[model samples]
Target: MERITERYRLAVRALGKFHELASRDTLNEIERDALIQRFEFSFELIWKCAKELLYVQDGIDAASPKKVIRACRETGLLSDAETEQALKMVDDRNLTTYTYDEAFVASLIGSFPEYDAVMHSWLEKLK
Candidate 1:
């Protein structure tokens, strides 16, 4: 069994958590914080799995999250909008590493649905 399958499985579990959190009308600071963390980890798995699959199948070497997403898009595994949204997720993940500001964190909450959509699409494609 390929590691990509396991990676995708973990990402999907994170995806479920993200969706559960997103569906809430309100989250306390702690829940919101956890949601942010889940998004970060999920996207990490998402891109790295994509990178692994690309390397295995096409000998494509995308060493970074952004590059792997673009490679996935170029190979037709993802659409342009999904690719662009994925890039923003990467940017958001980077932003989360350095801040605990509520306002900044709140802004990123909107990214969950978009991230979820694209990630689920990628999982289906991989399946």
Candidate 2:
């Protein structure tokens, strides 16, 4: 498989693992932290795959979140609203990694379900 295809597969697998974690109703603090970390990691993986696909398909080099999301829109992979969401997600990803704020992490955790659903839908369409 091509690198982009491999990345997509990895992203899908990560998302699947995140889904498994989220489906459980009872989780300890450590489990919850792990789940959130998985969710964030999967989101980044999905975005990386999406950007790679765009690069392979259109010769577009998306170096920033806005550019990456714009590439997705230009390639018809995401609607305007989804692009907006993706941009926000990217920003949240950066913040989650760089900042030491619990509230930001909590907000990102809350967004995981939508992120997973959007990524899964896009992957299905791509396949």
Candidate 3:
């Protein structure tokens, strides 16, 4: 529970940074990469928050990613499409972290706005 709270705080901080970066007009590749990484990390924290909420409220098992995400949808913490996108971002983030390929990173950078929209909407729900 403490960990979940810490994660939520961290995610909120990361989202603040994301907003700061987004406000800038121009970013170099490295800057964009940093922002993308932070964005991905924030999404992971959102997932954790949803899972912890479900676990606390419904006593659902949170060990399995699939189960946690399903519980999130069932509990109205996330929509079906949002859960799917978050899972995809998790997978893509893993690949980007391990592979270090420019093309894929570019693709990820291009997709950042969509992810940001999803995250912002989720955050709004929290508010």
What would you estimate as the lDDT of candidate 3? 0.72
Best-to-worst order by lDDT is: 1, 2, 3
Candidate 3: lDDT of 76?
79
Candidate 1 per-residue lDDT over residues 4-24, each given as its tens digit: 788878878877887788778
Q: For model 3, how does the per-residue alpha-carbon lDDT over 37-103 read when each residue is reduced to its tens digit?
A: 7876777777677667677768886875557666767777668788787677777777876887778
- Candidate 3, residue 100: how far the Cα is off, in Å: 1.9
lDDT of 2 by residue, 13-119 (tens): 88888988877766787887888788787877877887777777788888875787778888888888777777777787777678857787667767877776776
Q: Could you tell me the TM-score of candidate 3? A: 0.80
Candidate 2 residue spans exceeding 4 A from truth: none
Instruction: Give residue 54's lDDT in candidate 1 (0 to 100).
Output: 92
Clashing pairs in model 2, backbone N/Cα/C closer than 3 A: none
Cα error, residue 89 of model 3, in Å, equals 1.0
Which candidate should be chosen as best, given lDDT against the real structure?
A: 1
Model 3 / residue 98 / CA error / Å:
1.2
Q: Candidate 3, which segments miss by more than 4 Å at Cα?
A: 1-4, 22-25, 64-66
Which scores higher on TM-score, 1 or 2? 1
Q: lDDT at 103 for candidate 3?
A: 88
lDDT of 2: 0.77
Which ten residues in a row are the worst by lDDT in model 3? 118-127
